[model samples]
Target: MSDQHLLLLSILTPFAGAIGIVLLRQRPNLREAVTLLSATLVCIIVVTIFMRFDNAGLMAVDIAEPLPGLKIRFEIESLGMLFALVASMLWLITSIYAIGYMRQHKEKNQTRFYAMFAIAIGSTLGIAFAGNLITLFLWYELLTISTYPLVAHAGNKKARHGARTYLGILLGTSIGLLLLAILITYNVAGTLDFQQGGILAGKLDPAWSGLLYALFIFGIGKAAVMPFHRWLPAAMVAPTPVSALLHAVAVVKAGVFTVLKVTIYIFGTDFITSSGANDWLIWFAGATILLASLIAMIQDNLKMRLAYSTISQLSYIVLGALLATNTSLLGAALHISMHAFAKITLFFAAGAILVAAHKTDISDMGGLGRAMPITFGAFLIGSLSIIGLPPFGGMWSKWYLGMGMVETGQWLLLSVLLASSLLNIAYLLPIPARAFFGKAPDGTTHHRIKEAPPSCLVAMTITSLACVLLFFYPDPFYELAMDIGGTK
Candidate 1:
């Protein structure tokens, strides 16, 4: 197939799977088979595209021109390729994890859950390959709408409330702030196509750029830069697979991915640095990083704690983008993949706990690891990776980010990055630590508890191993990130 055909197919495959899922809803086995098939096809297609990609510049295909000079387009660039690869591959793994989770947990609306999950992956692929700001915005909104059903899958009061917050904040920010920013870009530049060095550099005055940049920053909302971040934690009432999707595979990744996209392609790193547009704004990312980490340290609910941890980890990318140095941009890009693997493994472990032992609060998890050794061991590897420790993927990203701070002499932000890692250790390490070493509550034995279903263990094992393998190899992703940072 032609690259353009493949590009279009990548987005359509998941939607096609969604249709098949709905049609086969009555046959649970058939419906799930469709889901897995679609996910596998997407992964294969994306890998093909990556294999054929030319890193010299972007390759684009215009799907439509909605208005004069405004087109819906798709493109493959280093960053987008990385994002697409991560989302597609993880979609397959998450599908495996979901089958185990939904079947064992006996979650309601299983067919609907599978269908919406497919659509959400489709929307995410659209966002990843978007060649212009308008195209990205369209897919961005579709992602929000498609995932709403999944977030509310439980159909309880808490689930409904979390879904509302998820929908409200995402829509409000995109319409109220993000759309405004796009309009301003179009008005100033006469086009919304993403360019390598930025179209806004000479056209928009540097003095007013900070105000416009703020619109893009807060407007994106999914980056979870505080005050706007409540939606993330609120959405934790969702099923664990959905939580994995939101944090690891799609939602939060899209937010930070767009932030990086705007930095490199929309704003241009040099333009941001020379104009000093992000000087004061960078602190918001810094604050979000520390404050979110601090809050994660306090949460007792396991999923809630991971949710807050996601909010903090996301800002690491935002901070990298705002810094605008090539190294910082590289770190931001690399983190997109590193964080995805590590965080998803953590959520998968959380789900495993819920399924096997019916535990939620950390206080109740003591000594449970003895019974469910594999699940807790996976969580330990994931936690160590998130803490940026050796023999894990996350270490590479944090190393580059810290190097970026040093290159720019941003000592304060460097301190923030270091401090956040400590907080990560404080909050994340303890879960696995307590599971293994701490006493079981009320001296209750957990011998009856067991590991999650085979499929769940399979998914977690793949991602957990990825954390270690990435540390040793960190290939294609490292190469792709360097391409964006212009360091290759």
Candidate 2:
């Protein structure tokens, strides 16, 4: 198939699968089969599209021109390709993990869960391939709407509250700030296309650029910069698979991806640097990084800690964007991929612990590693990666971020990076260490703990190994980042 056809297929496959899943509602096994099949097919299509991006140079296919000069389009560029590849590939992995998770946990409304999961993946692909601001906003809202059912899947009071927060913050930000920003850009530039340098360059007065920058940055709330981050932690009332989708695969990735996209494609790195429009935002991103990590250090629940950790890690990408240097932009893009693998592995292990030992709180999980050694081992690997240690994918992104800081002579931000790593170690490592060394909370001889089901183990193991493999074979992701950053 042509690249354009592949792009359309990558987006539509999951939507079609959602309908198919609903059709097979009464047939649980067959319904799951549809989910896995659709996910696998979408991954393959997205990989092919990435290959096309390299072979034929970046391509943009116009799907519709709804109004005069108002086009709805799909584009394949280095950054979009990378984001789409991450989302699609993880969709397949998450499907496998979810099957084991939903079955083992005995979740109700299984059909609805699978269908929404499919729709969410489709929306992510739409965001990934969006050619302009309007296209992206449409899919961005769709992503929020699609995942609402997943967040509220339990239909309980807590779940509904989470879903409301999820909707309120995301919709509120997009409509309130993002849409207004888009209108201001259109009024000034008259075009919303993702241009090479930026559409707003030399068009908007420098006096007002800072305000516009603020609108775009905060508008993309999935980046979870503080004050808009409450929804993320609240959404943890969702099942682990949905949590994996939010953190690793779709929602949060889309958030940071939009940040990078707007910074590079809408604001232009050079324009941002020349005007110093990003100066104040840089400090805000730094504060989000350190403060979120501090909060992560105190959470007793594993998922909540990871959620806070996600908020912290996301700020790293946001900080990289605000630095407005080539190296830092590269770091921001690489963090999207690196953090996805590492965070997903951590979440997968958290789910495995839940399924196997029925434990959620760190205080209750003493010596869990003794029984579920593999799960804890995977957790350790993920923790080390997130800490940005040697021989892990996370290290490389942080290295480039540090280089960007040095190049820009921002020593204070470098200190923020270092302190955040220390905090990462403080919160993440102790869990495994306690699991391996400390005693159970009951203070009695325990024998019930065991490894998670086969599927969960398989999924977590793959992502954990990916964390290590990325350190050695960082070429593909690095090349994509360099392409997006326009680096040598």
Candidate 3:
């Protein structure tokens, strides 16, 4: 198939599969099989685009004309390709993990969960390949709505509360900030098409440009920058797979991708730097990176710690965008991919711990490594990756972020980055530390513990290995990111 056709399929295939699964819902095995197969298919299509994409040429398509001068369209540009790859690849891994998790826990309404997840994946694909602001906004809202069912899947008070928070923040921001930002763009730029070097760079004066930047940043709350971050941790009450979708696969990444896109496409880096419009964003992002890390350090719950870590890690990308340097932007792009593997592996391990041991507190995980070596080992690998250590994917992004700091001559940012790395270690290392080195909790009866389900272990192990593999073979992402900043 042509590239654009493949792109369209990548976005739609999941929805189509959801329909198929629903039709076969009477047979749980077949329904789940459809989910797994469809998730795999989407990943294959996304990888196809990445493998075949001409980094030199923009992958564009005008799906249809919508108005006198507006249209519905999509494209796989550099930033979009990174998001599409991460989302698509993780869908399969999360699907495998989800099947194990949901079945083992005897979760109800699983059909609806699978269907909503499929639709959510479909919407994420739309965001990744979106060619214009209109297309992205449409898919972004769709993503919000589709994930609601998953958020509320438990049909309990806590699940409902999380669903409300999840829907409220995303909907509120999109309606209040995101839509206004797009409307402003349409009026000022006269077209909402994404372009190289941005369409708003010189269109408006500094005063107006700063307001526009603010609108876009707060509008895309999925990036979870500080005040907008509560939704992420609140939404953690959902299944582990849903948390994976939020943190690694779709939701948060989409938010940051939109910010990155606006940085490069809406407000050209040169324009942003010259106008000094995004200068405040640096401190805002730095504060988030540090503050979230601090919060992570204090979280006793395993998922909560990872959630806060995701919050902090996401801001690292945002800081890179605000820095407006080639290395920083490249690091931001690479972080999207690297963090997905690392964070999802951690979450997978967390879910496994909960399932096998019925434990969530880090303090309760003492000596788990002996019984659940694979899960704990995977967690350790994931920790190394997040700590930005050698032979792990996190190192590359950290290296470039450090270089971005130096390139921009932001000495203070270097301190923030280093401190954040230490914080990453502080929170992530302890899980494995306690698992391997510490003894079981007093009177906890260590003999009763064993590894989680084989399926959970299998899925987590694969993702952890992926963390190490990406460190050695990040050329795919590196080439795409290098293409982004023209550094290569």
Candidate 4:
């Protein structure tokens, strides 16, 4: 079979799974089986594509010309292939995790949750393989719509409010600013196809490029740069699997991925750097990174704190894109995979804690780790990785990002990176620290809480181990990043 056909199949597999899930709605076991089977199939397909990946873009398929000179297309590039691989493989892991979580929690609308989860993965694949801005925008909006149901799974007032904000911000930004940016870009360049160097370099005037850059960055609200980041914490009312999907696997990754995509393929890194079009982005991202970390330190709710931590971590990617140096772009690319593994491990641990201890607040988690040591241990690994410490995947990305800053002589940004890591420790380490070392409240001894279900433990442990594996085997990601910059 051709790669193009495989590309199409990867996108369709999840949608087909969603249908199968609905058809087997009465049989919860069968419905979950469909999710697992489809996830496995999609992972295999994406991995095959990754193995076949080449510097010359493969699987290029122009499916339609929606308007004169405007084609809707799909293709796999180094960066997009990396994202597709991450999202596709994690879909399988998250499905395993979700099955355990939903069954243990006895969540309502389990079928809907599974179905929407499948649809969201389909949209994510579309985003990853999108060959141009129009194809990307369509998939981007579809992802937002598909996940709204998952966000509001509880059917409560809080869930509804969160879903509304999620939809409102994502849609408003894309339609209002992102769409406008696309239109202006097409008008100026006469095309939307993503090119290796960039399609906008000579066509766009330097004087107005900054405004265009603002539209693209803020318009991709999923990046969670401040003023537009409230939707992230607001959506924490969602179940833990959905939180994992939003933060690590799909939503937030899409946002920062798009920012990096625009920087390298839409605007051309050299052009943005030389034109100073990215000046505002660098400052905004640094502020977002530090401020979000500061706010994360104050949150007592475990998931809420992780949500804020996601906001801060995402800014690192945006800052990398704005830096526009080869090393920084490489950092941005590596972080996409490193942070995914680490953050998902953290969220999976959070869910496991919720399932086993019935605890949500950090203050209440003291000594809980004594009983659920595995969950807390995984949480510790994830925290250290997020802190960008040694022997973890996250350190390499931060190292490249700091080196990027040095190459560009942006010591202020480098300082922000250092300070954010300290803040990452402040907010993230305390959870596991309290779980293991701190005393429980009221000075009372509580009954031993067991670890989460086997499925949850398997998922969290796999991700935690992956964080370590990435540190040792960082070459694959580094080579892919190098491919993106034509440095290979």
Where model 2 places Cα greater than 4 Å from the true spot, the runs are none
Candidate 3 residue-wise lDDT, 1-488, digit = tens: 89878988998899999999889889999999999999999989899888898877786888888777788888877778888888888889889989988898888988898998999999998998898889999999999999888888888999999889989998999999999999999888898988878888667888878778888888898988888888888888888889876656689999998899888887888999999888787888899999999999999998888999999999999988888889999999999899989999999999998888888999888988888889999999999999899999999999998899999899999999999999888888978988888887784656787888888888898899999999899988888888777676
Q: Which ten residues in a row are the worst by lDDT in model 3?
A: 440-449
Number of the top lDDT candidate: 1
Compared with the true structure, the alpha-carbon lDDT of candidate 1 equals 0.93
Q: lDDT tens string, model 2, 1-488?
A: 78889899999999999999999999999999999999999999988777667724667789788867869988888888889888988899999999999999999999999999999889999998999988998999999998999999999999999889988998999999999998898889889999889988899898788889989989888889887898899889899999987765589989999999999998898889887889898888999999999999889999999999999999999999999899998999999999999999999999999998888999998988989989999999999999999799999999999999999999999999999999999999999999999999889544777689999999999999999999999888899899888875
* Decoy 3 TM-score against native: 0.98
RMSD of each: 0.8, 1.0, 1.2, 0.9
Q: For candidate 1, what's the RMSD?
A: 0.8
Candidate 4's displacement at residue 210, Å, is 0.4
> Tens digits of per-residue lDDT for model 1 on 217-304?
9999889888799899988889999999766659999999999998888999889998999988999999999999999999999999
TM-score of each: 0.99, 0.99, 0.98, 0.99
Comparing 2 and 3 by lDDT, which wins? Answer: 2
Model 4 residue 325 CA deviation (Å) reads: 0.8
List candidate 3 segments past 4 Å from native: none
Better of 3 and 4 by TM-score: 4
In angstroms, give how far residue 418 of model 3 lies from its true place.
0.5
